[model samples]
Target: MIDSHNHTSFSEDCKIPLNEMIESAISKGIKHYTITDHLDLDYQDKRFTFSLDHQARREAIFKAQAFYKPKINIYYGLECGVQPHIIKEAEAVIQKEQFDFVIASMHTTHKKDLYTQAFYHGLKPLEAYKAYINEFAWCCEVMNEFSVVGHLDIVKRYDLSLNEVNLEDVKDEICQLLKIIIEKGKGIEINTSGFNDIFQHAFPHPTILKWYKELGGSIITLGSDAHFPEKIAQHYEEALNQIESCGFENITVFKHMKPFEIPISDVRASLKLDIL
Candidate 1:
C-alpha cells in the first residue's frame, strides 16, 4: 500500500525524526510512502507555525532516499497550505521544486483564523460552518498544481463539538469543490485520521465520496496522516473497504505529479500481510 500523505518534524506540529517515521512505516509493510511535511505561510497559532525550508527539507529527504530506496520507495513531498492570499507564493515554490507529490490543504481561513474558541465566538454555528466551507471551496479554485487535496472537510478537526454541522447543508458547495478538483485533475485524499477521531469515518464522509464518484471523479489517494510511527497505515483495511463501498475500483499514487493506479483487490491483499 502507498501512504501519500504524512508529516514529520519538518512540519511544526510533528517533532519526530524523519528516519524514525520512515522505519515505522517500513515495519508496517508499506511499500511506498511520502513525507508530506507541512508549510503554512501565515497561521494564527504562533505555536503551530513553522515554514519549511525547502532547501533543508530537500536535502534531508535526499539523504533518507539514499537509505530507504530499493527497500521502500521514499517520496519527497510537501503539504502546502492553500489560502487565497498566499496561493501565488505557494505556486512559486511548487514550480521551483521537483517534489514527488504535493497536497493542498486548507488549515486556516485567513491569517487570523485560528481554531480557537475566539475565532468562532460571535458567528452563529451555521454561519461559521458555511464560512469554513466557503474558504475550502476558494482554496480548491485557487490551488491548481496540487496532486491531491487533503481532507476536504478538515475544519471538523477543530470543531469536535460539531453537533450542528450538517453535511446536507454543505453538500452542494462540497460537490462544487469536487467538480473543480476533478476539472483540475487533482485527486482527493481519504485521510484516515478521521477514523481515529469522533467522526469515526474519513474526511468528507462516505456520502461525499459517493457524490464524487457519481460526479465522475476518478482520482483518489489514501493517507493515515500519521504523526507518529505507530499510526502509519492506521485503519488501512477499513479505508480500502470504504473506498470500494463508494464504488472505487482503484486508488491513485503519485510520482512527480504523474499518477499510478493500484487495484482495490490487490490493495486489500497487500494490506492483509498476504504478499509473498
Candidate 2:
C-alpha cells in the first residue's frame, strides 16, 4: 500500500523521529511511504510553530532512503498550511524544495485556526462552513504550486454543530471549490484521520470522492495523516472500500513531483485487505 501523507519530528505537532516512522512503514510492508511534514507559515498559534528546515529534513530523508532502499520506497513530501496572506511564502517553499508531493491544506480559515473556537465564535454552523470554504477558495485561486488539496472539507471536522450539517448544505460552495481545484490540475487527498473520530468518517467524508470523480478530478492520494508510528496506514481498508464505492479504479502515487496510478485492486490484494 502507498501512504502519501504523513508527519514526523519535523512537524512541530508530531514528535516522532524520522527513523521510527520509516521502521513502522517497513514493518507494515508499505510499498510506498511519503513523509510530508507541516509547513504552516505564520500559524497563529503562539505555543506551536509549523516551520520546516529544508536542509535538515532532506538530509534525513536521503539518509533513510539509501539504507532502506531494499525494504521500501520513501518520498519527500510537504504539507503546506495555506492562507491568503501566506500563499506566496507557501509557493516559495515549493519552488525551493524538490518535494515529490505537496499537500496544500488550509489549517486556518482567514488566519484563524480552524480547531479553535476563534474560527466559529460568532457564526452559526452553516455560516462557519461557508466562511471556511470561501477562504479556501480564495487561497486556491492565488496559489498555483501544490499537488493536491488536503482534507478539502476539513471544516466539518470542527463544526460546532457536531456535523449535524451535511455536505449538501454547502453543496454549491463545495462544487465551486472542486471546479477551481480541477481547473488548476490539482486533486484531493482521502485523509483517514476522521475515521476514528466521533463522526466515524474520512476527512472531507468519502462521499465527496464520487463528486470529485464525476467532476473530472481524478488525481487522488490516500493518506492516514498519522503523526505517530503504530498509527501509520490506519483504517486503510475501510478508506479504500469507500474509494472503490466512489467509482475509482486506482489511487495516486507521486515520484519526482509527478503522479502515477496503481490499480486499487492490486494495492488491496498486496496488502491482504478486504472491505471492512
Candidate 3:
C-alpha cells in the first residue's frame, strides 16, 4: 500500500525522527511512502513555528530511500498550511523546493490555528462549518502549487462533541468547494486520521467522497496522516472500503507532482487486506 501523507521531526508538531517513521512504514509492509512534513508558513501559534528544513528533510528522505532500497519507495513531499492571503508565499516555497508531492492543507483561518478553541469560539456549528469550508475553497481557488487538498473537512475534527456540527447543512458549500478543486485539476486525500478520533470516519466523510466522484474529481489519494510509528497506514482497509463504496475504483499517488493511478483491487491485493 502507498501512504501519501506523513510527518516526521521536520514538522513542528512531530518530533519523531524521519528514520524511525520510515522504519515503522517499512515494518507495516508499505511499499511506497511519502514524507509530507508540515510547512505551515506564518502559523498563528507564536509558541511554535511550522517552518521546514527543506534541505535537511530532503537529505533524510533520500537516505531512507537509498537504505530501504528495493524494500520501500520513499518520496519527499510537503504539506503546506495554505490560506488565501499567503498564496504567493506558499507558491514561492513550492517553486524553490524540489518536492515529489505537495498537499495544500488549511490548518488556520484568518491566521488563527484550527486546533485551538479560539477558532470555534462563538460561532454556531453550521456557521463555523460554512466559514471553514469557504475559506478552504478560497485557498484551493487562489493557490496554484499543490497536488491535492489534505483533509478537506478537517474542521470537523475539532467538533469532537459531534452534536453541534452537521455537514449536511453545508452540502452546498462543500459541493462548491469540490467543484473548485476539480476545476483546478487538483485532488483530495482521504485522510484517515478521523478514524482514530471521535468521527469514526475519514477526514471527509464518505458522503463527501461520493460527491467528489460525482463531480468528476478523480484524483483521490489515501493517507494515514501518521506522526508516530504505530499510526503508519492505519485503518487503510476501512479507507479503501470507503473509497470503493464511494464509486472510486482507483486511488492516486504522486511523483514529482504528477499523479498516477493504481486500481483499488491492486492496492487491496498489495496488502492482502479485505473488507469484513
Candidate 4:
C-alpha cells in the first residue's frame, strides 16, 4: 500500500529517526511512502514549533535517498502551511527543491494564528469553525505549487467541540475551496490520523469525500500521516475501503517528483497476505 503523508525527526514535533521509521514501514509491507515533514514557518505556539531548518533538512533528505531507495522507495516531500504572508516563501522553497510531493496545509489561520485553546477563546463554536474554513479556502486559492492539499478538516483535531460544524451548513464554501483546488490540479489527502484522535474518523469526513467525488474531483491520496514508527500504515485497510467506497479506482504515489497511479484493487489484494 502507499502511505502518501508522514513525518520524521526532521519535523520538530516528531523526533523519531528517519532510518527507524523507514525500517518499520518496510517491515509492514508499505512499499511506498513519503516523508512530508512539517514546514510551518510562522506558527505562534512555541511548543508546537518543531519544524526543520529548510536548507539542512533538504540536504539531509537528498543524501538519505540513496540509502533508503534500495530498501524501499522513499520520496522526499514537505508539508507546508499555506498562510497568506508566507505564500511567497513556501513557493520559493518548492520551486528550489526537487521534492517528489508537496502538501499544502492549513495549520494556522494566519501567520500568527495557532491552533490553541486561546485562539478559540470567546468565539461561539460555529464561528470558530467558520474562521478556520475561511482561512482554508483562502489558502487553497493562493497556494498553487502544492501537489496535494493535506488534512482539509484539521481544525477538528484541536477542538472536538467544533465537530458539530456540519459540512452541509458549509457546503457552498467548502465546495468553493475544492473547486479552486481542482482548478489548480491538486489532489486532496484523506489523512487517517484523525482516527487516532478524538474525531475518530479520517479527515475531510465521508460526506466531504462524497462531495468532492461528485464535484468531479479524481485525484485523491490516502495517508496515515504517521508521526511515529508504530503509526506507519495505521488504519490503511480502512482508508482504502473508504476510498473505494467513494468511487476512486486508484491512489496516487510519488517518485522522483512525479506521480504513479496504483490500482486500488491491486492494493486490496496485496493486503490479504502477511507480507506485502
For each candidate in turn, the TM-score is: 0.94, 0.96, 0.95, 0.93
Q: Is candidate 1 or candidate 2 better by lDDT?
A: 2
TM-score of 4: 0.93
Model 2 TM-score?
A: 0.96
**Local distance difference test scores for all models:** 0.82, 0.86, 0.86, 0.80
Local accuracy of candidate 2 as per-residue lDDT tens digits, 1-276: 888989999999898999999989988878799999999989887677889889999999999999999789999999999989888977987888889999999888867888775688888888888888888888888888888999887787776483877778887888788899999988899898878777566777766777788899899899999899988899888888888888889888888879999899888886784222
Best by TM-score: 2
Model 2 ranges with Cα > 4 A deviation: 160-162, 273-276
Better of 2 and 4 by TM-score: 2
Native-to-model Cα distance after best TM-score fit, residue 9 in candidate 3, in Å? 0.8
Superior candidate under TM-score, 1 versus 4: 1
- Clashing pairs counted in every model: 0, 0, 0, 1
Candidate 3 stretches with Cα past 4 Å from truth are 161-163, 273-276
| Residue-by-residue lDDT tens digits, candidate 4, 7-39 | 988888787988888888888777777889988
Worst 10 residues of 2 by lDDT: 267-276
